[model samples]
Target: MSEVPLPSLEVDVPPEGLSIGETARATGLSVDTLRYYERAGLLLDPAPRDGGGRRRYGSADLAWIAGLVMLRETGMGIGDVRRMAELSRTAGTEASRLAVLEQHRERVLADLARTRAHLAALDAKISSYRHAVAEKENA
Candidate 1:
């Protein structure tokens, strides 16, 4: 199947910022998960708000949340992601960020190798099944 491009994070979030419910709807994440991310420090500080003090999320915030989702899906630990988020808040820390990213890349590579091996094993089993079926038909 052709790759489906993800919606532009920049476009989905409004300049004025969206409420928690809006963000959840845009990101396909639940309100509870968004709150959990905030509590986990995975998100940077949201924009300040008016009376009633509702959290407002801008485009940048949505972009960051999308990145967090990608990281989590790629097997990054929440603690590590939280640390990365803290590091992002610091300026002039390219070297530190690179180190963390490199470590994560290594882990992902290892995981990919294991996954490929399992897929190969499954493929072999499938081939065996096909051959067995063919032999039964011939006999």
Candidate 2:
């Protein structure tokens, strides 16, 4: 089978960068969420603002926002996300960042184990029901 290409949400970014709305569209985040992230200090310092006070997001900002989105979607808490953002601002904090990611990975692994156990139990019940029905029909 041929692999299908996913539709791109990319927009043409001008030299001046994109407006807050355009960024929200490109990043799949709401305008309010973007504002909240800025206010919550999830973003790096001094995100570019235009002369009219509108937010201008450049490529670097978009990439950082994508990382933030990935961490959040993976069930990272806001506090941890904030910590990761803080850690990113400074140099030589790779170890700290790795620790945070490692902890989250542990949680994800535990959840996966529980989910697999649940799936096994469900499959066993399903097989038993199928066998019972077959036995009844044969008898």
The regions of model 1 sitting more than 4 angstroms off are: 1-10
lDDT of 1 by residue, 1-139 (tens): 2322333564555566899888888888899999999988888564457467998888778878888887788899998898888987877765786788799999999999999999999999999999999999999
Candidate 2 stretches greater than 4 Å from native:
1-12, 125-139
- State the number of backbone clashes in model 2: 0
- What are the lDDT figures for the candidates, one per model? 0.81, 0.84
TM-scores, all models, native as reference: 0.86, 0.79
What is the alpha-carbon lDDT for the whole of candidate 2?
Answer: 0.84
- Return the top candidate by TM-score: 1
RMSD of each: 5.5, 6.6
The CA root-mean-square deviation of candidate 2, after full C-alpha superposition on the true structure, stands at 6.6
**lDDT score, candidate 1, position 102:** 91
